[model samples]
Target: MWLKVIKFIAGILAIPLMAAVTRAFYGNIVGVVELAGILKYFMWGVGAYIVLHLLFFKPMFIYVLGHEAVHAVTSWVMGGKINSFKVSDKGGSVSTTKTNAVVELSPYFIPIYAIILMAVYFVVAYSYKINGAVFIFLIGFTLTLHLVMTIEVMKIRQPDLMKSGYLFSIVIVYVLNIIIIAMLFSLLFPSFSSKKFFADSYVFSRDIYAVIIRQMFF
Candidate 1:
């Protein structure tokens, strides 16, 4: 029971927590910009949101899809035969008859691919750097996609990894993710630390039912 509880905490904290943090901080800043009598803030916010969701949706989805594909492909490459694979709105799973550290670890190493994509983006946009505001919005989108993938990887695929005192693994994933996010931001905008964003957080999705019930009477 304790093991499950710890695993749940670790898995949830791995990525979703950080993503939630980013949203909270950015959302709050946007709100503050609104309060500062900046009409353009809202315009930029809305425009950026719409453009990001529209233009990047397909590419991000492909990235998300390819992310899982990497896992499956890696498994095959690592001498593990995949038995079954499933993906849905919430999570995904891939069963294998045999597993290796490399295959099992592939899902958590998305920053490697992200780095390559970011490089290509920079090269194409080389003459013009991606602007700061746009970069913030882009990282926000990327982080959200990352959260979804992390939920799939952490909660469903490798719950045991976080539970096994593999604190080193968690650190590695966190640092690598931060680096990739920061670099991607640097390519366009000035970078910010995860700490600057989310100071504290609650897992809203996991507690949505409770939150709804509590807010219903209020």
Candidate 2:
């Protein structure tokens, strides 16, 4: 009975959480558009996305490995012991003694491949004058890969989300993905700060509340 009540309350909170996240994401995207050379970088990203989409590139092997790895890693972080880990081209899963929403839902939000690419980029950038266009293109390519694959996986009924509660999982995944996208934009354009993004979001949220209050009274 209490669990049902909790889930109902969480579902109610998810609506507002999604709204706030969408507003912040839109504001940051607008900010990114205002920056110089952003269009060219964006084009590079778009081109990369097109190429990947056309190729129907699906790194199921790598994704499966990362998916299970994230489960194991998070479980360990939460002081849970892993009984076994399995991965294949079809799918992957982990067996752990510890289980929670964070552990279950992490892989959906964390882009392990992108993180690997960024780490390699940093190392290469230290030694070579990597072309700006190429760097931006790769970023776009990997990001699109992550986004597309995530959606494809999410289309199915995932046990992880079910165990975590659908409303709670959706809210968490949306918020984390929004924050990650904002961070990626900041990485592409150094001028756009994550701090400023949050500040703008706060202001936007406050204005929205004020408007709602006025509408209620008037």
Candidate 3:
């Protein structure tokens, strides 16, 4: 009970951080818009996925498969022994000997499908000289797939969210998503560095918290 209470407080405190990260994401995009070479391929891939989504061609089964696989993989990474794993078009579940915030909430944050795609790219690159554009396009495609599914799933009550306290789960998921996406952007776009991202995040967080403090006290 006390642990849940602590998580609740931490969750509330994390709102400022989430907002800051979100601001940094927008700022990062604005910083780099030179669509000449590789960036164009990335944008093309993003646009393609957007088109697919609009046509109601969502691959829910694929999302569910990757989602449950992440749960099982994260459990193993955290020293938990998996008992059983099941995934279907409707939903998925994984049972492990260990349970924690990381294991339970990982599917929401970790883009397992992206990692799988990256692995495939690496393997192909090892043998053949993979084009930079192809790599960027694949990253863009898989990343969109992960982000879209994550947003849709978060709309309703999830048992995973309940375990970690829904507020805390959401804060963690949102903040991690922002950070992960920002890191990927930084890697792909040299002009938009992570250093600038952190600086912007701090400024945004400070201003948001300042406003909240003033509202409460002044």
lDDT of each: 0.52, 0.76, 0.85
Query: Considering every candidate listed, which one attains the maximal lDDT?
Result: 3
Query: Can you write out model 2's per-residue Cα lDDT over 1-218, one digit (the tens) per residue?
Result: 67756866886655565677678777667666445564677567867776766786777777779888988999999999999999998998899999888898888888766777777888899999888667666677676767677777877858988776777666778778777878867776666678887887677667776777798898
Order of models, best TM-score first: 3, 2, 1
Best candidate according to TM-score? 3
For model 3, what is the C-alpha lDDT against the true structure? Answer: 0.85
Q: Could you tell me which residue pairs clash in candidate 1? A: none
Root-mean-square deviation of every model: 10.3, 2.9, 2.3
Badly placed stretches (over 4 Å) of model 2 are: 33-35, 41-47, 50-57, 207-218
In order of appearance, the predictions have TM-scores of 0.40, 0.82, 0.87
Alpha-carbon runs more than 4 Å astray in model 3: 33-36
- 1-218 per-residue lDDT for model 3 (tens digits): 99999999999998899989998878787768544556778888888888888886888889999988888888898888989988888898899988888988888888887777777877888898978887788788888888888888887868888889989999999999888777766766677788899899999999999999999999
lDDT of 1 at 23: 55
Clashes of each: 0, 0, 0
Error of 2 at 205 (Å): 3.4
lDDT, candidate 1, residue 70? 62
